[model samples]
Target chain A: MTVAAARVPAASTPSFIGGMSRRAKVIWTRRLVLLGLVVAFEIYARFIGNPRLFSPPSAIVYALFDEILVDPRIRGAIYQAFTEVLVAYVMAIIIGLVVGLSVGWSNFGRRSFYPIVILLYAIPQVILLPLFVLTFGIGPACKIAFGVSHGIFPIIVNVVAGMRNVNALYLRSASSMGASNFDLARHVYFPHMVPSLFAGLRLGMTLTLLGVILAELYVSTGGIGYWTKLYAETFDPAPLFALIAVLAVMAILLNELVRIAERRFTRWRN
Target chain B: MNDQANFTTRSIQVAFLAIMAGVWYGLTKTGAVTPLFLPPMDIVYATFMRLVQTGQFWSAVRVTLFTIAQAWIIAVVAGLLVAYLVTRSRHWTAVMEPLIASTFAIPLTLLFPVFILFFGIGPASKVAYAATYGFFPVALITIAGLNSVDERYLRAAKSMGASSFDTFRHVLFPAAFPVILTGLRVSFFISFASVLGGETLSSAAGVGKAISLAAELMEPARMYAWIVFVIITAVSLNFIVSAIENRRREY
Candidate 1:
């Protein structure tokens, strides 16, 4: 008993330190590498890079507040884009869920419409950007429509897959217990589909963002697209870089929110 | 029961397509939607046939295809090299994988303006933009594939005094082949799409530019034709890739 007690500290001590050091090393390396890259870029942009083509990080930071934020029009454009994404995402979830359930619920639905869905999904929807704009006009309506179109396919695919792959035993047992179709859907299918649905949501967010941004850029008359084009044309890299950085941060935040929701919804799996 | 379901589904599929075509014809014939937005189906078909005959269409197709090929090649080489190097160490993998993934999440399209600034409004810009965009999936998937090889196999090979190259050739290559192939497939599509998008947004020439020009010119029929051509190409590519993947899986 005494030997065992004494050996506990000996065994735990090295492993605890080793694990801590390994984690620390990883974190430090990641930070240092990123920092090094940024610093390199800064130096290049300041000294060697063309002013019209690149801006230093410091200048970009200044431009973010002084130039980008100060402009009410730009701010409104950014807000409009954000709203477009939110509305499109919600619409996508609703439509995708309905479509996915309808298509996946029955064998007939799966065999008949799933192929069509897949065919549509496989088409590079970017090619349709012009068509969407022409049909919906050069407004947020077009962007939202485009975003929804991009986002819905993944959700539908994932939900159908989830429904199709639900354990047969679970369904059989539920049916044997005299569960109604509604009860079967609620008790057996919903839980089975949650994780995959969340997976689809995450993908859908990315695609929706891509779609909206693509439309915005394509229009190039107003909104974020116009500003980006304007900056590019006028040889102003600082504000352009700053604006992109802001958008990137927004994208990261949106993605993180979806990831958080995914984790929360899939907690039952653990 | 299965046979009945299959038959029903097949009939439904046919009915659905027929109804869609009918609706298109009816709407155009009734002039509910203007010809400017939704050109008559016949005009679209005629424009497609005419486009097929045009030297301009061929040149645009050639340009886009050439750009995609170059971008995909660059992406494959760079992505594989980076992934392979990063996978050489566990610590490096842990540190770099998330960095790569997070960077990928930032919608690389945002940087197209920067690319334009650097490479100008040409196929060169499209190539660079697409290669940069395509590199992420390839590298990330390759890293995952390489990292997932059975440790026991590696140990056994080491115990048998197998060289690194031999072990990679015999064990690692086969095991990682499937995942890497998936990555390649994804990267190819991404490169294709990004190239098209870049061209659409800002380019002097290409299929995308043609479509954009048609849209600007308010020639809905011509634009629809180009759109049709792109859709057909994309769908065919997808079919070919999936077929190849399935064939590979059977082996």
Candidate 2:
């Protein structure tokens, strides 16, 4: 298996120049394909497609700043949603790290509680959205709580796995050097866990975004959800598309931030 | 010492669960937490039993299950076809894999409005929304699986003058099966969650809708019951998928 894996890149890399040019060509083709899709959508939306159901990209872009951003309430809602995600994510990291360490540090703790944690993680927490609203009320609190709930599990699971997966050889060597528990953790286990923890952070971010948005959409009395619901109900596709576009951009930026952090922290892996 | 440690841990696990149930019971009984927020355990159980006996519960479950089934089917077909096409060339794989993965980062739930506009506020909307949301993971994982197929195996197959179809069947398919199965499991749960989320957001039918309705009507017990049912379903699905994967590994 290892030989086969090594042979793959060797076979593929022989025509490095050809590969580079082919990759460049493919990148251009991909861009053109996306442009072509947009042009097609524009033409269809302008002619055949119902304006209420579909909006051209040009119109959507125009509405993004003109109609959506111009509305102060809508802007506030978007800002609020962003804040909720940020706050929830930070909280998730802290809580998840603490819980993960507590649960994963000892073999007995892991054996006793890890299965229960996994069981909780398996449950679709979306089912508890209403319950969250009932408990936290229809405010940013509910959304933040939901996001934290969704985000924390992945971090905890990954951290526990990371702690358990530290090389036994490394531990033995560290102890042979008369390293203390803290030294072993700081120099060996912590570095080893960085990559996995970042993986969890990425997943946790996605789930946090999902949870926050799901709650926001459910409680459509205010927030970005209200604007989306309003536009959809009023059959206003342009503004709705524009609003969704802004949120999509926000989600992408947030994910990219996490990705950048992951790259920075996991540099030693290379 | 190890045996004593094991016994202590086992006892701790049981005690943890018991204490949780006890706190819940005590809170509701003493009115420390309102029944509206945390219904009494007995009331929740009674409601669960009653819901199971009702045709309404079954119908809601059926709607949700049917929507998930349709969404999963569409996601699998479309995802595999796209993934297979993308993996045909290394260049295409390089260009498309990141495209699919980056899109997965964007909360596709944000596009539920577009789905609602297109499909209306029915199970159709939920199906469309879920299938789109579920498509990314499936397609991305399938691409990864197909890309990871050992080139040596393909080369050997070609050296033997094997047909492309035979090479794919004998070499590629078996190698990709486990990853693709994992993708399928993930997609199934994605579909399930998205369907429930759609129903909760806008739909007039399904288990999620039922839960929302119960909550809106202040029927806390019924709401708890519905939530419990969904949790059980999710847990059971996880177990079933894990069991199947475990059994397959034995082969």
Candidate 3:
């Protein structure tokens, strides 16, 4: 009997009705909870909530098409915000990479500069928003610059960290085989730092978006900032909600794009 | 040798700051950047000294600090509560952790307008905005901390016939305290910064408002004074927080 019991398999196979995988169950439960919350919110807004201060989900959806898409200025503001974020993100990556390399390259440089970099990072950059506007004017230039300022630090930190751990033996062997400094950096350092760089890129996108939005909102003379101010002052909550939703969706999509690229580049780690 | 290396690095760091100051002085002197955009360093220092002596400056600082305090309290309480609830079961943690993290990927700054609408453009709105911003990091980190408790320790507690409350108090809380403290530190900074951002965007009062107000009036000297003060405060706070964290880590 003991031998027979030892040979028997466990009953862990998936069944049709009551044996759903934990992952699937978690997903379904999350979806249901999200749907329920939305429904509850819709009900509250339509019946009891103040229209001027709060908007129902259905009206928000309708306003996205009827109010936002119909207005050319609103469309342009959205487009400008998007363009600013793109420009800022690219600039941040390039500048961050260069600065990070130069600073993190040598022992003396890293020792002297990394603390300064971190100190600068700790200072809330938002306090300087007004100065940026004063310098660059209330244009896309100011917004892009501000965004780059916010986004670059993460990349610099990550790049330095990535470079810190390069295999000494590999460097020794490469140099013994007559590899130049440039060759060692390009071949050994770059590939090793790719994973960390991607992590920075992902975070950089989020911070860049944050910076751009802060600038857009701060300069209330034009663009999405103007519209948001106008809508809030006029108590047109629907368009305001709709506009925010669109921006949120845009942020999510951009973040997802960066994340996908990160996964693709960092596949070797897994 | 280590002490010598440290001294050299420290000297180099000091030199770097001196160079930056020199650059700023040069930039102002050369008119490469206008004094309107970057005020003269001496002028800014004088303005900062003058501002600190005034009651108005202190009031604005007090207001901003008070708002940050309120926001941080709300964030910490709500965040820990949610984290506790979510981490109670493995299933719940798996389901909610990703959801919470994904929300952070979408920049919460986009929600500032809605906050202004509901709470008005006062310190109230700023508090709400900052609280929401601070909540994410605290909740995420706390959940991670709580979940990281060793399975063997938990099993040992269970086998020793300890109650769940006793197990949590003695076993779980101690193990998780460091991470939770880190989370709180991060939350405090996030709250501080976001409140400043909210005031800068739209507010009637606070240090951020004062800076913006000065800028709007084209008073670069005053604005720079406020900015410099904030930078000093932030750096000092960072050092203080790190020291506290290090002290706690020894135990």
TM-score of chain B of each: 0.96, 0.94, 0.95
Alpha-carbon RMSD to native, per candidate? 7.3, 4.1, 7.5
Place model 3 in a CAPRI quality band.
Answer: acceptable
Q: For model 2, how does the per-residue alpha-carbon lDDT over A119-227 read when each residue is reduced to its tens digit? A: 7888878788888999999999999999999989888888888899888889899999999988987888889889778777887898899889999999989998888
The sequence of per-residue lDDT tens digits that candidate 1 reaches over residues B88-175 is 7788887888788778766788999888888899899999999998898788888888888998998999899988888888888788
Clashing pairs in 2: none
Candidate 1 residues lying further than 4 Å off, grouped into runs, are A1-18, A175-182, B1-7, B162-166
- Which candidate gets the maximum DockQ versus the true structure? 2
Mind giving the per-residue lDDT tens digits that candidate 2 earns over B33-147? 8887899999999989988999998999999999999999999999988988888777777767767777777889899988998899999999999999788767877777887
What are the lDDT scores of the predictions, listed in order? 0.87, 0.85, 0.87
* Worst ten in a row by lDDT for model 3 chain B: B242-251
Segments of candidate 3 deviating more than 4 angstroms: A1-20, B30-32
Residues A149-169, candidate 3: write the lDDT tens digits. Answer: 999988888788788878878
Lowest summed lDDT over 10 consecutive residues: which window, candidate 3 chain A? A1-10
Model 3 / residue A207 / CA error / Å: 0.6
